[model samples]
Target: MKSYRIIKSPTEGFYKEKGSKFLGFAYHVNSLEDVKNKIELLKKEYYDARHHCYAHLINDGNQKLIRANDDGEPNHSAGDPILGQIRSFDLTNTLVVVVRYFGGTKLGVSGLIHAYKTAAEDALSKAEIEVIQIKQSFVVEYGYEKTNDVLRIINDFGVEINNQEFLAACTLFGRIEPEKYEALKDKLNLVHVKVSKT
Candidate 1:
């Protein structure tokens, strides 16, 4: 995907039904490490919780990795509904975890699903959602004579230049959206400039 929505920061909300309480957390995550770290932190924070159901969507350049765990709840009752909320928002690179306090009442499967769904929805509703473009990094090398052409390409493609050098041969380090990276790489190749992924 060229772009996707994600929460701007960590957020949380709560729901209660039949004396059972669900505490939902939403966090912006970009890697498996982030997912693991957040889960670990929550587990320590809610050590007495009966369950810690969670769902995560991580986009790593070429593909999306998803994880949903019921954490002892009935199959598809907790995790799946939380994941459904993420999907309903068309979001990626996010994680939602629901920590349950038994409250001495066992919610049936349907009730559990509704509680988890509402908890996730409430957390997301409090989040600041923003659309972000997928980016790719590249290093471009060209002769000094082609400086203007290289600058033109950067300007035209909206490439973000991170570093550059001016010498007999010039080097530019930059990043751009994937689509623009492909098109700019092709055009730069025609000018005898070298472009490689970073």
Candidate 2:
């Protein structure tokens, strides 16, 4: 419940109908800016393509921001279908783009939807899906003598350390699931570790 799935790496897919070629791309995006950058890169790469339709979901496991663009395609023919595939896969923080290279033949609304859907599905199928826990950063500070106790407690809670300094005082920057934050506080209290949200 405190986790979500996203693509681990960028991937590509292809679908063809009549003479038209559909090239699909998948990526894991971290923010709205990331989504824009990716789409801009693709548009630059396929500047001459007929249309570049895309769908994206940003901020996985938190506030979800989603968008679908049909570009020049007919209404609901391209973007919606691609979005449907992303939803079907239960993916978050992901973006799927399909570049269209017109082939002499025209794909009606139905045909376009099918083509876009299949292309998006192909790209997703090729990607490696990874699950990430929804977590928040916390700073834990403790005295030198309580280092062992603090380490043991954090380790027991599966908190991932991001930074640490063992000077006169021991300070650790880490990420832990929000659901476990309260329990972590309780356990760390016993060890006298000072913990605060980052």
Off by over 4 Å in 2: 60-62
Give every collision pair in model 1.
none
Question: What tens-digit string does per-residue lDDT give for candidate 1 at 1-198?
Answer: 777899999999899998889999999998999999999999999999999999999887778899899999999999999999999988899999999999887889999999999999999999999998768999999999999998998899988889999999899999898877789998898888999999
TM-scores, in order shown? Answer: 0.91, 0.90
Positional deviation of 122 in candidate 1, in angstroms? 0.4
- The candidate 1 region of ten consecutive residues with least summed lDDT is 178-187
C-alpha positional error of residue 108 in candidate 1 after TM-score superposition, expressed in Å: 0.7
RMSD of each: 1.8, 1.9
- Model 1's C-alpha root-mean-square deviation from the true structure amounts to 1.8
TM-score of 1: 0.91
